[model samples]
Target: MKKNMDDVRFWPGNIVVAEAAVAAGCNFFGGYPITPSSEVAAHMALLLPKVGGHFIQMEDEMAAMGTVIGASLAGAKSLTATSGPGFSLKLENLGFGYIVEAPCVVVNVMRGGPSTGLPTQPAQADVMQARWGTHGDHPTIALTPAFHQEIYMETIRAFNLAEQFRMPVILLLDEVLGHLSEGVIPPKPGSFEIINRTKTTASPEDYVPYDTSEGDVPPFAPYFAGYRWHTTGLNHDRTGFPTTDPDTVTFDEKRLMRKVTGNRELIDKVEYFQADDAEIGIFAFGSTARAAMVAVKQARAKGIKAGLMRPLTIWPFPNNQVLAFSKQVKTIIVPEMNLGQIVYEVERSVHSDMPIHRINRVGGVPINPSEILAGIEEAA
Candidate 1:
């Protein structure tokens, strides 16, 4: 049998992410090899050079993150990939990216662990860490994709959100989804819009890297591009110089946060399946959402009103959508690979006596559809 090669392509999940990043105009990759996510860097190493992009295996995870930030500041669409342990190592630099608003994508193909618990197994435990692993009240944008095709598209969106908001965007993938083989039909070139960071048109003499006069997200001026501005981890004024003044510090902090929070409508993405008039709402994400969707279908067949709300953009958390979904459903079932991370968020979102059940699994395995369906049945 001859298969059509016109629009069909088979790739492992990590390769899809790499190819998608390239398609999104990512020109630089600096990542350390870690299990489940190593394929992303390996494929990036092979693909980037073909497009006149650069790929570097850094000394370690921390350096990998630093290189990505530097490359992004030098006018490159930069990215890095890692798993749980490496993700932890990259947090300090990740926080720096938030403070300086460097545009880059960080891919965390999540495996089990607080500290290298399961290097080769799947887990959705990094959802909270992606949002708050770094210190301070900085902004965060994270996208979680369940399938190979979503991995491809969401990886591109990760780069887009990073460049658009001038901060690091995290692409979170469970180990199962990262290692799975699946077919993807990517859109043709120019089929969709790709975003690049807004560059400053101000002359060299008038460059201000953190200027908020125009909007919350300031135009970026790449280094060595005849533009000079200070970049620091400390709170800084519009000149990008460190400031201790209360007013300037306050203003800088608020703007950094508001860039993402104020644009929640643009950044938040939640997928609802069979949710309308659902009696039992299941909240899940990453690969677990995939299972939950199956559970919803099965429940519907069994004469149960089940729905699934999958948060594609994890941070920013899609609280509004969850709240609205809560109003329509009598109960919400939270299922995830971790012990119980996002369930707390669901409880907070509903903010009522609504019965929210949990179907959590740890120890390096995915939560299956049957388990979720059982949860739905119990809830019903």
Candidate 2:
């Protein structure tokens, strides 16, 4: 397909976020229906066809992820969106995408819950799930956007990261961020970068799906059309075959890890407000980060040197950044909808430096800005 550089259409931020994936060349979606995150799938259902993409509502979350991996293996930019419970169910295939280094996007519109805790209420309980939900050792990129505009822009960015690293990227949005409607002007037509998968027309005699070249991400050729490729859940070599050969296994496993994990500079993004010359740092992500922002602004009004640290990329937690801030700040405030998930990461990253204070609300409501301000005050 020839690249279309023509200026496209502009849309509302919510619609633009959902539709931008199609514009960014994402054509396949497979997901089970769930609240909050469902809008992404729903939006794709209506919007994908106009751009020649495909949407499949599978029987369940696991199958949804499986379908995406299959579509991506066939050279399609694919994705799936879900929330808390749905995310838990998809871990197996999420791991599959990691082992195979399949390029796709998974959106988690976080809601309150261990098991269907709160459906409509907004919560950021899935922070660690977005990070370590899948088992074993593998690298993943997760982006948390705090508002409606971010939902659109972040989704586009997620697709790009997935293609560049040859791995699945997760867009971590909470219910508040997913459903929040705010006016936003999308990028002008032809302003977006749509990355397509790299395809090689190698002959049937010499092609391996996991063949490692100079890059951390090995080049892949699709099945059928004479390219013989084998994919599995077990650790394997570049030929994609099961093997216990320790050296080959170690190299392949670490290669998979380095493909995304080693490229943190390219993937690390955050929003900093009042960070410079601040005595306190309020660390947060997703929707909670929005409240943190307001709290930081209010703190500054009261002559408190407090800053908001929002990690736009959450999975590869910004440890180095946190360490730098911890050394400079007197206190750190970590808040979320969950009891104590991300706070643990913050604690670990900073070596328990300074006072690590936590204010969390787990009853299914988004902790308001005022409450966060009170927490910051208490820390101060």
Candidate 3:
């Protein structure tokens, strides 16, 4: 497919995200429609088949997640999109993906939550959930984009990282970013790098799906690629067979985490605005980061040395960057649509003596520039 560089389209964030997936060579989409995220599924359903790919609207979120995992294992780059309620249902299978090291992308367009609080509203309440929702010590790579263009770019990055690291990657969007429409320049073919999973070169009898002797990440072969291997949610050994030996279990857990944590330099990313000499830093992510950027500009215009630190990759949290920024600032202010989820990580990274203030808004309303600016002023 050729793209016209001279053409521009005002695309909703969800559509752009699906376009990115298609551009990244995503050949299979297994997802059920849900609010604020259904457009992603709709777009995929329309586009995937046109590109010789497959799309399926599963019976439910759980089935949707399972389908994607199956597709990925069969050598297809697969994806799924969902909202908070659907996201909750995906957690169990998400863990399965982690354990099996299936490369796929799961996009969560966050809405007001905790038992369907607000279906059409936006919230950042899922920050911590994205990190620890699966209930394990496994490493997670989650990217949060603040704008439509970023929604497109990061969706591509999510697939690349998933395939590279051989684990499920989350593209965390919010209701605002998912539903908002904005003009965007789609990337031309061959403009951006696309990564595919590495396949093993060893003979079938010698192949070990979970081997770590070469490195933390084992090269994976497609299920039907003449390689027969066992996979389970239970602890597994180098050959992919289930095991409960204490040594094997501990080794497997460490390798699972090391694939992501040990390579944080390559996977973790952040955007810093006016942060070099600022005394007050505003920490945020996702849609909240967009408003925080505006607030920082306003604060700077008013002679306050306020800057913004927006983490593009939320998990495997950027501890070093946050701590270093903390030392250079007197206070750090974190604003989110949730009631202080990321602030806890900020507090843990910053010096105990440094004041940390959180500006939280819940019940579907977004945190506006005024609220963040006020917090900046109060911190200053």
Question: What are the Cα lDDT values of the candidates?
Answer: 0.91, 0.82, 0.90
lDDT for model 1:
0.91
> Where's the lowest-lDDT run of ten residues in candidate 1?
1-10
Model 2 TM: 0.93
Candidate 3 on 44-147: residue-level lDDT in tens?
Answer: 99999899999999999999999999999999999999988999999999999999999999999999968777999998888889999998788899998888
Cα-based TM-score, every candidate:
0.98, 0.93, 0.97
CA RMSD (A), model 3: 2.2
lDDT of 2 by residue, 171-234 (tens): 8877777777655555665887766566654567877677667577776677566788888999
Candidate no. 3 TM-score:
0.97
Instruction: Give Cα distance to truth, residue 236, candidate 2, Å.
Output: 1.4
Clashes of each: 0, 2, 0
What CA root-mean-square deviation does each model show from the true structure? 1.6, 4.1, 2.2
Rank order (by TM-score, best first): 1, 3, 2
lDDT of 1 by residue, 43-140 (tens): 99999999999999989999999999999889999999999999999999999999989999999999987888899999988889999999999898
- Segments in model 2 whose C-alpha atoms lie over 4 Å from true places: 1-16
Clashing pairs in 2: 8-189, 17-152
